[model samples]
Target: MERESDVDALIAEGAAAPVDGWAFDWLAGRAAEERPPWGYARRVATRMAAARAALDVDTGGGEVLAELPQSPPLLVATEGWPPNVTVAARTLRPVGGRVVAVTPGAPLPFRDAAFDLVVSRHPVRTDWAETARVLRPGGTFLSQQIGPGTVRELSEAILGPLPPPADRHPERAVADAEAAGLRVVDLREATLRTVFHDVAAVVWFLRKVVWTVPGFTVERHRPALVRLHDRIRAEGPFVAHARRFLVEAIRPAD
Candidate 1:
């Protein structure tokens, strides 16, 4: 009875918390994930320092972009989610960055060769052709992408046993980039540890990272949540692995 009450309270806390912007500060002590060794944010800052013009694709709430110590002369970020567009604009205002609302999987709304540097962190999908089109000759496109089967353990904990990951492989991305006429200069991969102290953390994460469960809801997955909560109580904290990859491609000089 006491365990049930605890579960109920935790679920309510997680469900009621706002899942706005891409920041994960809400999960402070509830969950933790190891950072990738490639240091994507630091790399972006270094590149941004040298860029004349830059574009950030799928800039969720512009949180990552807001961290850069320096900004390009012309800095632009694109977001697909409407809620995030407003958040991103306000967050990037101090940096003189403009936020453009774009449709997911649609062509980037930019003139050819519009940006000298293009970056994206965990974009839902990469339109390689569109990315290439917007990049100037000798420009670079850098991204830290979510690899196939990222956080599969957490996903399966909520959902059921799943099949092998079918896509999001670094090789596939490299092939797509080459096909789009971008030269692949660097590629790196990492599988980092992720831990959740309670079921509430899982609920909030699934809600924010929607791709984890196609259609996640506290009510719909309550049974699984309960089971997971019990399992965590019996075992230690739940553990999962998050896969990430960094790719750097460039357009050849004209």
Candidate 2:
């Protein structure tokens, strides 16, 4: 059995790590999560190649957008998190992409029909109406979204049993897109296996992905963390499932 001191040290390390940007490089060897079958990044790259103007909503750190081989003439990205704006701007500099900071829930600050393509990856919330309003006629909107009950097992491990997930249903997204005057073209869902090799990984993940445990704190949840650490030492690595969905919609021609 690992010493209690070792566990405490691991927890402290995780708690001290910075949670800036959307990248998960910190969890490299300690955790693993399976990716969806559909390659969301590759899909975005393909679409972006054909777009005259493209907008990336909630483009955290512009990590994914920076990887696109080709950038549209007018490439723009929006981020609600202030710290990520500068990070995104620097990352996307080589691609000639601009990052704009905006309020989380406010309407997008852009002219109507300004973009021929819009994309988002794991947005906190989808503003379907605002997305449609900013797209040019016959433009496409593509997104990889977090599905309902995503990473619930990890959450339950930390916070105990919880209520059923009530939102982020694929059907609901289709309906919302249609209501916003966009035609849904495709939808897909995936449940991925996620494994955490150590308690530190769990703590870091919860800190970075705040939605996992609402208001998780090492001090407040020390007992639970201890229990989980013990469980990991006794049993094998803790296992969880992450759910994701991809949706595509297109604004009709004027």
Candidate 3:
């Protein structure tokens, strides 16, 4: 029991630290490389090429939006992080895109039926109700998001046992869309595989890049770091497998 407690302590300590610059830089680079080619942006762009206006929620780095062949009249991007928003806006503005930095968990700033297409990649918003609320009749809502198994190994090593494996609810995004009177179109799940140079890289990514959960303090994370290093030495380089879902739904043409 003492050994188990010790291990748990180590895990917590290793995960401590506010995720900031180093983490985002590391994650941005990795996201650029390993994110699926047929990801959220492509999927949404393909479906909405004819639309007059479009919005991308949480447009990190604007890489996905940049891939579109023809830009929308209103190529608006919404970001929650001020720094990231500034960076993304700087990168995207050259291409005639506009950026809006919003407070987290707040309703989006758009009129009803304002957009013909709305897309998001791993949006931090708990539910898609707002997404559905903002879409015009016949507008499309497309998203690709990380599911529950996003960092199973890391979570286990650092945070102790995790909840039982279950399909990510995405806060009932689908149901929210339906309640808003959107028609369910298509939904699919894919397992994504990512390789890390080392366990430290993986840990760095979880802390910096992913930033899924908050409240990791340095004292809490130190022991976890030690355990992770020891585990890596024992187990060899880390390979992370994550489950992601791609969902597409459309507002009915009334």
Candidate 4:
């Protein structure tokens, strides 16, 4: 059994840790999440091996991209968050990839038909038209996206009952892909089990994933966090389900 002081220390440690870059090393073993069965990283490595030029959108810290066993000759990545851009540049340097600081919802800084393959993992937003424009004939776009209402169990723990998501369904994504003149070759969705072993884990996650509560701060949500902490102390770990989806599209060979 953890003492109250110990728990408070953990929470403070989590709150002070840098949330920049997508790396979650801080949460190692503190929380666990089931991975989607599709093995997105291995799939990306396979595709990268066959491409001549590739771009990665919203490449947070280049953590996933840097792990690729192989990379295309011309590798480029974009990051919207400034802190992550620096981290990504450093992480991707050894892999010979360039990182661009991009503005959210703004145009991608690349030429039309510039890449043969484009990939992103959990992009903040998918610019379907820009994705189509950047791909050469017969190029492919592969992404693992956070589906609607991901981690609602955690979000609602902090904020009270919320409205249901109106969009981000795979069907909507397919329609948008088709509308952008890309063919949706494959798409899949999954709900994975997630467990926060401690309140500190929950606090760290909410801070890193800002969308969870929009404006989650230790001070603002301390009351809710305390409530959750008490619940954990009594009920073991807090359980939640994380939603994710995989979408693959290809530009027509014509």
Candidate 2 residues 39-119, lDDT tens each? Answer: 999999999999999999999999889899999999999999998998999999999999999999999999999999999
Model 2, residue pairs in steric clash: none
How well does each candidate superpose onto the true structure, as a TM-score?
0.99, 0.98, 0.80, 0.97
lDDT of 3 by residue, 1-254 (tens): 77566545534433553443212444433232255555666666676567688888888667677667777777888888776776777777766788888888888998888898888877665346777778888788888877766757666666788777665665465777688777778777666666554444545565554443345544556676666666665786555666677778888888
Candidate 4: stretches off by over 4 Å:
1-7
For candidate 3, the 10 contiguous residues with the lowest summed lDDT are 21-30
Off by over 4 Å in 1: none
In order, the Cα lDDT scores of the candidates are 0.95, 0.94, 0.67, 0.92
- Write the number of the candidate with greater lDDT, choosing between 1 and 2: 1
Candidate 1 — which pairs collide? none
Against the true structure, candidate 4 reaches a TM-score of 0.97
- Regarding TM-score, does 3 or 4 come out ahead? 4
Q: What TM-score quantifies how close candidate 2 is to the native fold?
A: 0.98
Residue-level error in angstroms, candidate 1, position 157? 1.0
Model 1 lDDT, residue 137, Cα: 99
The better candidate by TM-score, 1 or 4, is 1
